[model samples]
Target: MNVLPQSKHYNLTHYQQRYNWDCGLSCILMILSTTQREQFLNNFEAICKEEGFGSSTWTIDLCYLLQRYQVRHEYYTQTLGIDPNYTQHMYYSKIIDKDEKRVTRKFKDAKAHGLRVMQRTVDMDVIIKHLARNGPVILLTNASLLTCDICKRNALEKFGYAGHYVVLCGYDMDSKKLYYHNPEVQDGHICRCLSEAMDTARTAFGTDQDIIFIYEQQQSSDQ
Candidate 1:
């Protein structure tokens, strides 16, 4: 693993998600920096909506959004089909087939855009290396195990392991903590969880161990 940045030094602006389903999109906005986004952010939201974001923000859907903005990154996944945990989701029964088709089509579109989608698993070492290089990582995690305030407040945890995306900002080896920005809350920046909990929350069946390894310049007026 590469030398990790001190958690206190990783300073990405914390942009909270506006809705329960927009966490994935919000992660992208935080990575791309919302400062010069007067026009960029508007178009970003427009493209997100144009590409099936109003309903749900799937992993492949995020790739399409990044490609549209000329963002540099690799889309990684542990599965190439419908979310295996679809059966556990609230509306899974009605939307399994539809969600599968949508995921397949958008996946192909993401490829046609020349985005590199890597099919494999990622571990803590990989996440740390990217953070060491000052790159941002967007991770899919089970919200239930994350001890999220919003989840507790809304009784969302009752639904069980809802899949959510967060921006992994840094880690503290000494503290054995994984730090990330949970868009679900207003003070989501650098929210810390035990290293064990982080792995468990993200590697669950619903997650597919999905990750977006962004290789942007880390430049933004806001940062």
Candidate 2:
């Protein structure tokens, strides 16, 4: 098992709770925040021990591999010892229905008129809507690309994909800039050219129509 720094390990746990999304950026932030590199290596060893997995090299790589494997492995269920079928049913009937439109005809009677639908909004739109509701939405997004930023080019080179997920905490329609919560940057906020954000939004989330409106909990809302 490899040791990982204290700060890095905590960052991974913290970001997972905060972002609640699947993008590797949370893990990337974990690596970036730990000041003690050796301590960071130790943390990976701890994770492997708890997960009952081993690695050729005990380092952050092992932590990454275990987490990824657990997501798909049947052992994930065996360890929990709970049938996930009910959860899957609830996921389809309730959670996903609330967030996304289910267009698959198999879900309905054959003679019913089917409707074209869109899925959930991209990360930016969700964050923006949160701000609208709360008047100061603070959210993290994994940004690995920028059209003009020099650092962005380097990130792309290393990551082999421009699939950066950026936070849009707020938007200024008049100024045409979107504010972001970027964990990778020392600065708290990064301003993106609106067009660039739009382009990224199109690539990251294909449609604006499926934007999930944040209705009041008491409000009767149906998809």
lDDT accuracy of residue 36 in candidate 2: 34
lDDT of 2 by residue, 1-223 (tens): 5322111001121233133233233333332324433343457457545533232211122223323332111000011111234235532234333322222221232123222122223455444444344322222222333442322432344432222333333455455555443444444334444535444533432111112121122322111
Give the alpha carbon lDDT tens digit for every residue of 41-87 in model 1: 66656665677655677888888777767778898898776766676
- Range of the 10 consecutive residues with the lowest summed lDDT in candidate 2: 72-81
Error of 1 at 217 (Å): 1.3
Best by lDDT: 1
Q: How many Å off is the CA of 177 in candidate 2?
A: 1.4
Instruction: Give the total clashing residue pairs for model 1.
Output: 0
Q: Please give the clash total of every predicted structure, in order.
A: 0, 13
Candidate 2 deviation (Cα RMSD)? 16.9
Question: Residue 89 of candidate 2: its Cα lDDT?
Answer: 50
